[model samples]
Target: MAARKRKQSPQHEDQREKVRFYPAWCKRCGNCAAFCPQHVIEMDQWGYPHAVRTHDCISCHMCEKLCPDFAVTVGEETPSSVSRRGAAGPSPGTEGSLVSQDHSPERLAKTPHPDEEEHD
Candidate 1:
């Protein structure tokens, strides 16, 4: 008999999904890059965060929850969020839902977004 190739299970398939990052919201903070236990995240010239090697991600959510600007939202992409593409939401370049009025721009600018261009 010929040897058969083993099929990958659903659990294994789920593990292969790539991690997505929101670049617009990122403030160039290196928190995600510094905190990644798997070292999956990396910073660009602008200091913004990017997922260089998603396969190494452990789904720790440290990048998402720790993000002060809510710029890094880590989660399984659901059909609902995708379906509502046109839904009204916060504007780009502004701290909409992720921060409160009490938070100042100086503070936000100081904190780097996982996916943001370097700013002075």
Candidate 2:
């Protein structure tokens, strides 16, 4: 008998906004899928969660927080009114998120440090 391949949802997109799954670290606890309000994620035969309706995701990060093993990560969701793609990384849930900050050498160097000044 030939080895059977897992059939997955065909509507997958290559966009940055997605529910990332780390199988190696996953314990298949099903917490993520059950807590999802949008019902974007679904468990397969082996109890592994997969983002089936990624477009419907609100980037709530509910799944990410519910996971006990940190097996899931919800990618940043971009709205039509705003575009975080221009920034360094994905849009964070908060304005002060570190992902939106520019950590480049030039930006870091420009930042002032009180301790760097001579106390004498």
Alpha carbon lDDT of each predicted model: 0.55, 0.58
Question: What are the per-residue Cα lDDT tens digits for candidate 2 across 1-120?
Answer: 111232334554653347766544456688998989888788876575777766667789999998997657677443421232232222222354343223353443344445445642
lDDT for predicted candidate 1 compared with the true structure: 0.55
TM-score of each: 0.51, 0.51
- Report residue 61 deviation for candidate 1 (angstroms): 0.6
lDDT of 1 by residue, 12-116 (tens): 456533445554455667787898777777776656566765655668888877777665655676653343222212323334434442445555345543334
Cα-based lDDT at residue 34, candidate 2: 93
